[model samples]
Target: MAEAPSWFGEVERAAWDRFRAEIPWLTEADRVLVEVASTLRARLATDPAMSVNAIAQLRMCLSAMGATPADRSRVDIPQNDDDPLTCYFN
Candidate 1:
C-alpha cells in the first residue's frame, strides 16, 4: 500500500480532533461525513493525484461540522514548494 503524503496524517488528525470537539451530538449525516473522510484519507494515501479534490471534500465536511479554523494562521495543512500537489496552496 502506498503511504500518504507527509502532511496527510497531521491534517487528517487535526480535522478529526476538531470534529470530535465541535460535534458532541452527531446526526446520521455527520456520521456519514466522518466515514467518508476516513475513507477518503485512506484512498488519498494511494492516489495522491486526487489530493486537491479530497481536501476540498474534507474541508466541506469540516465546515459543515463547524470545525473550520477560527484563525486561518492556525490551520497548517502541508505546503511543499517542490510538490505541485501541495505547492498550489502556498
Candidate 2:
C-alpha cells in the first residue's frame, strides 16, 4: 500500500480514521474510494476554490460506502460478529 499524501493533515487523517471506524466492512477494493473521499473532504474544508463537481463526487462516494445516515441501511453488515471466519460462510 502507498503512504498517504504529504498534504494529508489532521483533518484528512481524522476523516480517514472515521471512515474506517464507521465502515468496518471496507476491504482492499475500497481503499481507493476511501482515499479519494478523504482528499475531497480535506479539500472541501481548506480550499475555498473547490469545485462543485468535487463536492458532488465526495457526497456520491460517501453515500456509496454507506457513510451517510441516509445510506446506512444500504450496507449489509455481517451478523456473525463473533466469528472472523463467518465471512467465508456468507
Candidate 3:
C-alpha cells in the first residue's frame, strides 16, 4: 500500500474533529467508526482511481455503529471529488 499523502493526516484529523462535534453521545463504537472512516479515506486518497465496493465494510460499520442517515451526512471523512466512493461513504 502507498503511504498517505503529506496532507492526509490533517484531513483525517479534521474529519475526526467534525465527527466528535456532530455526535451527541460518543461511544467506543463511535471511535471505531471514525477509525474505519479514516482508513478508508486514506486508501482513497492514496488511490483515487480505486474501484468502489458495492457493499463496503465502511458502510456496514457505520450501520453497526447506529449511525443514522443524518449522522452519515454530517460526520464525513475527507473525500476527493473524483472518487466514486465519495458519495457512498459520505
Candidate 4:
C-alpha cells in the first residue's frame, strides 16, 4: 500500500468525509487521486525516468480538487441540517 500524500491533513480528511455525506460525485475525484497516487508510487519506487509529467498531473488534479499549500484542502460539501449522512451514518 502507498502512503497517502503528506499534504492531506485533518481539514482535508474532514472535508472528504463531508463530501461523501453530501455530493456523491465529488468523491470520485478523491478516489481517483488516491488510485493514481498508488499507481505512481509503485512505479516511482522502482522505475527510473517515470516522467515528472505524471506527478504534475496528480498535483494539478489535487489543485482542481481544491488542495492548498497548507495541506488544509477542503471539499466544502454543504449538508442540510437534516442531512441523512450526518444523522444515521454517524
Output the number of the TM-score-best candidate: 2
When 1 and 4 are scored with TM-score, the better candidate is 1
lDDT by residue (36-73, candidate 2, tens digit) is 99888888878999999999999999998887888988
Q: Model 2 lDDT vs. the true structure? A: 0.81
lDDT of 4 by residue, 1-90 (tens): 223346655445444454344334344436756445445545554567778897677566556545544433455644456765677666
What TM-score do all the candidates reach, one by one? 0.40, 0.67, 0.46, 0.36
- Give me the runs in candidate 3 sitting further than 4 Å from their true place: 1-8, 42-47, 70-90
Answer with 3 or 4, whichever has the higher lDDT.
3
> Tens digit of lDDT per residue, candidate 1, span 1-90?
122224546656554454454554445555657655655655565566876777798677666555566533354433436777665654
By TM-score, highest first, what's the ranking?
A: 2, 3, 1, 4
Can you list the residue pairs that collide in candidate 3?
none
Candidate ranking under lDDT, highest first, comes to: 2, 3, 1, 4
The pairs that clash in candidate 1 are: none
Model 4 pairs in collision? none
Clashes of each: 0, 0, 0, 0
What's the lDDT for residue 10 in model 1? 60
- Candidate closer to the true structure by TM-score (higher is better), 2 or 4: 2
lDDT tens per residue, model 3, 12-44? 765455545654445554565666665665555
Off by over 4 Å in 2: 1-10, 79-90
Q: Which ranges in model 1 have alpha carbons more than 4 Å from their true place?
A: 1-25, 45-47, 70-90
